[model samples]
Target: MAALDMLEREPDLAFSLNGLARALKVTPMALYTYFGSRDDLLQALTERLLSGFVTVVDGDMPAIRRVEAWCFAARRFFLGYPQLLGLLTWEGGNTSVAWFDRSVVLIEALQELGFKDAELSRAIIWIWTSVMGAISEEIRNRTAPHSLSPAQVESLDPRLHKPVRDMLMLAEQPDHFDSFFAYHVERLLDALRAIAKRP
Candidate 1:
């Protein structure tokens, strides 16, 4: 948790165990005492943030509602943490199984809602990818300067270009992020619902 706090203050914490330890005024190896390895620490950091943000679902609640509540909390959490977004992208550089269990929790919640094996797998990947992608897009579009220039954004002008430009512009507006994220969330839930429907 301290490392996460330090990460917000120091972007280098995403990659540096030494930086995090130094911020906590401890030796680098001391961090491994709490976490088995640097990768473990990163997983723990991610888990800690999500746990703080996502409340546990009540089993008696409608499964669809449970999934919706879980994802909305997840999107809200990721949106608030810029440093976590960087670390999420950094995670692709390594193979860590530690975070998979957290993902399983999401998948299993859907399973209780009656999603079968293949659909559960698809749903898990779909939910994670869409939520992370949307938030990452919003963050990059907002904080980082746009890679596309105004001229570039305007250059595409056939039938579809206006819609593309409008979507790109919508991604940058802070006020619309919730609706943007919610639209995708609802769409994902719809897919899950179809997958769970009785034949």
Candidate 2:
């Protein structure tokens, strides 16, 4: 946790294994026993993040609800550790299957709507890209005054106000986080449903 916290606070300096080891108060060589190199540590972190999503959703809810929960959990996770955003941008050699497994649940849900494998894959890509793009924007412009919460940032900057308001408009009536998520998920699911109804 300490090493991750350091990395979260200092993205550039924390890119190396030696730096992580020093941050964790362990000898650099000691880290080698657990993770072979910086890349290995990054792979482990990605897996850990994905595993956390599985733990949060736990397969207990309805498919749509699970996706919504996963999105909220994922957003929170990224907000806590924005440094990981860089890792997510690349197609790393050490990608984790666990991440794919979480995505499979959503794809299967789409399949139930009669989407074929290719269609399901495309839907997943589109939904993930939308979610990640929103998250990336949030992280990049996160410097609103301490007095401002995310909700308040819109009101503080006229330029920001329009886009944020637009997103809220895209959300269902009685807009709130739950409604916002449901709105986006419904739109994506509706697209799949439409495809399903086609030949």
Q: lDDT of each model, Cα atoms only?
A: 0.68, 0.62
Task: Give the runs in model 1 whose Cα sits over 4 Å from its true position.
Answer: 8-15, 33-50, 56-59, 85-105, 145-150, 168-174
Tens-place lDDT per residue, model 1, 1-199, is 6765775665433446677777789987888887777777777665665554654677687777777776776666665665565555344486334346445557667888786777767777778778778777867756674546667766766675777778768766767767877888888878777877767
TM-score of each: 0.73, 0.61
Q: Which stretches of candidate 2 lie over 4 Å from their true place?
A: 5-18, 26-30, 36-39, 55-62, 89-94, 144-183
Which residue pairs of candidate 1 clash?
A: none
- How well is each residue in 41-95 modelled by candidate 2, as lDDT tens digits? 6667667655545425555565555555656666777667666666653444555
Error of 1 at 98 (Å): 6.5
Model 2 Cα displacement at 91 (Å)? 6.8
RMSD of each: 3.7, 6.6
lDDT of 2 at 197: 79
